[model samples]
Target: MPQCAIITCNNTHRRTKGGNVRYHRFPGDHNTRTRWLQVCGKTVPNCSTARVCSRHFSKECYERDVQHELLGLPSRCRLKKGAVPDTNLPLDFLKEEVLPGSAIDILLAVGLVPSQPVQKVSGGLPRE
Candidate 1:
């Protein structure tokens, strides 16, 4: 029941309906592991337990050989070397709820927009 290491991703090898999902471990090589960390934006010191499901990768990441097809192999496939996860952004970033307030109010609550009144110049342009 290996699950994706990404906090936002919910894909798991065990929950896949038809065993189509594949899980991959972090590379053993130092350089490759570093690259994986950079691509995945993870900072865990030990990646031995970290697993990434195939949904994080593009279709081109998997191997599709004639032998695999002939053998009637499960859809669980191995990823190509040097492959990076290039799938869509995780579900967490897609939330789109609108708060009941003016745009400035929301900005002020988040400390994004300044509260001070900006003085306008003679030409109606903001003074630097």
Candidate 2:
């Protein structure tokens, strides 16, 4: 049985009488893999042997066709590009940690910066 890669998730792709659960491998592309790692707050070595289960993805991540729905075909098993695991995470996962001198801190170091108000012109666009 393959277990989910997410540290907070415990869904295992085990065989069952009704059907077997599905797991997806981490993307091979550097950018995509980086995004996955960043979202999971995990490193490469930790995720090298890990796989995320389909339950982690949103319904949009899987493909569904009208015909398939009519015929009662199984939902598509493959994950779409840019699909991020969004389920079975710990509550703490929703809380982002702000480290000292982090980007947000740097941006707020000088206190709140005021935004320039948009000026409307006759052309229906803001003047530069």
Candidate 3:
């Protein structure tokens, strides 16, 4: 199972916990991936494998068609194109990547993550 890329989130695809959660992968484009990195407040070596769970996004980020649900039908959710994680997201979720000789390199060299997370949001496991 893949863990959420958000520093404080522990959400997984497990059946228990809440109910159902969704995980969105990092954008493939360099510019968009950089935007996501800035929003996420984290520096990752590989962007392709990073994922952000749905709990971080606002209702507006999702597609309108997936917003409505029929009685007894399972909910369908998908983010809008070019959507950026914004709602319930932390600006200080983690340290950022910066130029060489900055804390970014030091932290990366030392392999140090943020000492303690300020907060953690709980959500259901992902359906997929």
Candidate 4:
């Protein structure tokens, strides 16, 4: 679950207002352009925007976001018993799969790359 928090300042130190916080679940890459825009609401005219996480966004100011960002997760920490699968598989396995070369093609098609580099490493591909 992706969480969102609205920053607020009370009499003392600022904090994330639980009332304004919300959670969302997405079915795609978090960093994808569409994903960010979908999660981060439209920016108010002349207002600033910042995303604390993939689905949580703090707009207009950073204080409110910081309150929760610096703190811990929402009240309930771990997932409830039997709430979700207990598989130990990496998270990536659930995301849409793309062929290795397709990524390069997509990157180039998007003008992110004009050309691919072929580097010459010492000693038959230097050891990592």
- What TM-score would every model get versus the actual structure? 0.58, 0.56, 0.57, 0.20
Query: In terms of TM-score, how similar is model 4 to the real structure?
Result: 0.20
- Looking at model 3, the pairs that clash are 21-125
Model 4 clashing residue pairs (backbone): 7-64
lDDT of 4 at 1: 24
In the range 95-116, model 3's lDDT, one tens digit per residue, is 3654479776688788886565
Better of 3 and 4 by TM-score: 3
Provide the global lDDT of candidate 4 against the true structure: 0.34
lDDT by residue (39-102, candidate 1, tens digit) is 5654666699888877888889777776767899745477778776667545433335757799
Cα lDDT, model 3, residue 108: 78
Q: Which stretches of candidate 4 lie over 4 Å from their true place?
A: 1-79, 85-91, 116-128
Model 3 per-residue lDDT at 121? 41
lDDT of 2 by residue, 35-113 (tens): 6776564554755676877767878776656676789986557777767777666555656775578665766786866
Report how far off residue 48 is in candidate 4 (Å): 47
Per-model lDDT: 0.73, 0.70, 0.71, 0.34
User: Model 3: runs farther than 4 Å from truth?
Assistant: 15-18, 66-73, 93-128
Over the stretch 1-128, how does candidate 4's per-residue lDDT look in tens digits? 22322132021112433444333232234344343343233432221233232112323212244445568644332222222221222344335675466776878777897554566577667433
Ten residues in sequence with the least summed lDDT for candidate 1: 88-97
